[model samples]
Target: MVIVCCSILIISCIAVVSSGMKVSLEVDRPWLRVHLSQRAALECCYRTGAASLRTTWFVHNQPANGTAVPVPVRASDQVSSGYRMRGGVTCGTLTFAEVKVADSGLYRCWFNDAGVFTPGTYLQVYEPLKKTINLSEKTKDNILMAEGFLLLLCVLVPSATLLCKSKQLHALEQKKATREEENIYQGLDLNDCDKAMSLYQDLVANEQEEIQLENP
Candidate 1:
């Protein structure tokens, strides 16, 4: 007799629950990260079972607890925000447009059939700070880049100039050595030695002038 009574109670409870049973509200994009001063979309989805679905927007979990209201689902393609106007969930989706820093919080999507309740999902909005510098920062970056290139060029140009001079000096040395070998039978000549010394002095003076210009 007790078992029969318990069975009846169980059947009554199941009937009450299944009568209001609805599809699960699974929010596709829950955790959304956004940068400061940039626009983002908080997307949501509700799983509509065999029966057609109804959707309402909410914030901070509970619906009635705050100012969050239901966007009437409309039948047309005209999207009021991202969801249709008539609470008519198409493919069970919704979009929170132009999301801001203050919008950084939890959002809710409730699934319903007529006026009855089902289930929902929570969306976490994250606002990450981003720095977009003004004219001053741009100017500083440019100046730094220019100075670095200028220094590199200055160093490289002088090294190249010195390398060229050394090569020329080596050539001159070879020529003088050849002449000395030839003149071994003829005797000593002071003119060639004087010309080489003059060239050396000119190179030294030019290099010193360049160094002074660069440093200043």
Candidate 2:
């Protein structure tokens, strides 16, 4: 009787497994190949399965190879050894929000039955672009990075030109100011020399007048 029951159980497991699902991950295909920073969704779906079906979504593959993932009522699940919780199994679908590049992976979704429930789905996650990404945006970083390298040119180009122009203009102004100061000092010295010479000449004239008066 036990042998018969075991055989029946095995056969029933096979039958459940044979009722396989046509599964796929769903997202806008064009955005799949992009490199970006903003968030997007790596929407998991059993595209051909009916809503009446019950399933479970998992992060890392469970031991015993294909155990059903426990659906969390809250936004969290007991974090697996290497998996951080970012997605939830809703109905029969898995949804990850604020999708980053790290979110890319095979997400195994299985029907709640005993056998390794058909085939699981794989999700290729990615980050979304804030704006349209293009060659210009890619090159912009390199251009901005290279700006640091050309800093000598940036500073010297305009500064040297301005310095050259101002140097010439201020050269004449500085020279004129220096010349005026020297001229003022020289004039003062010359006036003092002239006054001394005139005083010496007056003394000689007075002495000669005395000599002439004595001789006459």
Candidate 3:
């Protein structure tokens, strides 16, 4: 009877082991960093199985083997470990109360019953970037401004050239007209007898009219 009871117990244990569920870790955020008004928090959740699941936290700081720290599915006062349960999912959070430069590394949450792991989350702790200029965007703006100026120049240059050419043509026409008038005056011949006689008669008539006005 003792042998039969032992067999039954063994069979029950086996059945329980076989009924254990496979689990997967769910990460809330993959990237963590130190920022103003924001604390560093890493959360991973997994569904509960028929049996209590074993969870482990691994931190890969160096190229060698990582440090494995077992995590209980219970809350702790320690700054490195914490747990919470919601909607049938158990979530484990690792909090860095005081983020350090050395905290920048890869972290992983592993589930043993489900034989699955959460992808590594890279945590970065550093000084926040200050307000500064974006040179790339500024450069693009400057290039566009320069292109606009060049386009304006391209339009104005041809217009100025055409204006100058018109002025030159107008000046040439004026000079040609003056030259033609001078040539016509030079071509007149006062030595012609009829022209000389006509000029003498006009002079005599002008002198007689001035004398008559003076006497009257």
Candidate 4:
């Protein structure tokens, strides 16, 4: 029973080591974007030194929904419809001479002998004209927003300044008026009681003379 358990443990260790020894593939770019009719390339490399290993390239097109379906890519030595395979042995490169919008997809390099596929690179193709138009529209929007901000500053700054000046002028006018009133009060001689009585008696005498002249 002990021997059987030891054998099982040895088998488990062998399996773990085998799994760890599996070849790992690396891709140069995970995502690539190019304009229509532009050249594009994807490079894949692996550490395994054996040149006899078969490598394959596959493309998965973006779908409306659900899982993407991968299609095998086959190319010959001579450029077959602009698709060509380059590099050798430990590395492989898939290239497109002139990429079309339809060529936009996820690409993966598979090591057939190792039964492993590298993490895919997604290719995106776009129209330059459309991108330029969208950029122009965004620029126009930014310009308009900036102009509106400047206009608001132009209006608000002057209005605030004029309001402040008007308040200052009103305060100054009130102060001037108050000072004039104070000067008028200071000019009065309220302490001259005898002079005031004499003026009142003269006013009464004038009134009596006027009444006599009118009756005559």
Top candidate by TM-score: 4
Against the true structure, what is each candidate's TM-score? Answer: 0.36, 0.28, 0.44, 0.49
Going through the candidates in order, what is the number of backbone clashes in each?
A: 9, 0, 2, 0
Off by over 4 Å in 1: 1-27, 30-55, 60-97, 112-168, 171-216
Question: lDDT by residue for model 4 over 1-216, one digit each (tens)?
Answer: 345434533553454346554453443466899888888877666554444446688888878896679898767542132222336425667888878888888887655565556666789989775443445788999999999999999999999999999999999999999999999988888767679989999999999999999995
Q: Using TM-score, rank the candidates from best to worst.
A: 4, 3, 1, 2
Model 3 per-residue lDDT tens digits across residues 1-216: 345434533553454347566443453465676754345788777665544466676665644455544333223442467578887888877776666675667666655555545655668877777869657888989999999999999999999999999999999999999999999989888778678999999999999999999994
Candidate no. 4 TM-score: 0.49
lDDT (Cα, 0-100) at 3 in candidate 3:
58
The TM-score obtained by model 3 is 0.44
lDDT of 1 by residue, 1-216 (tens): 345434533553454357676443332443566555445454454444455455555554325566555334333332233443235444445444444455544444444443322232334445565688556888999999999999999999999999999999999999999999998957756788789999999999999999999994
Please give the range of 10 consecutive residues that has the lowest summed lDDT in model 4: 77-86
**Strongest candidate by lDDT:** 4
Over the full model, what C-alpha lDDT does candidate 3 score relative to the true structure? 0.66
> Which candidate order results from sorting by lDDT in descending order?
4, 3, 1, 2
Which candidate do you rate higher for lDDT, 1 or 2? 1
Error of 4 at 42 (Å): 0.4
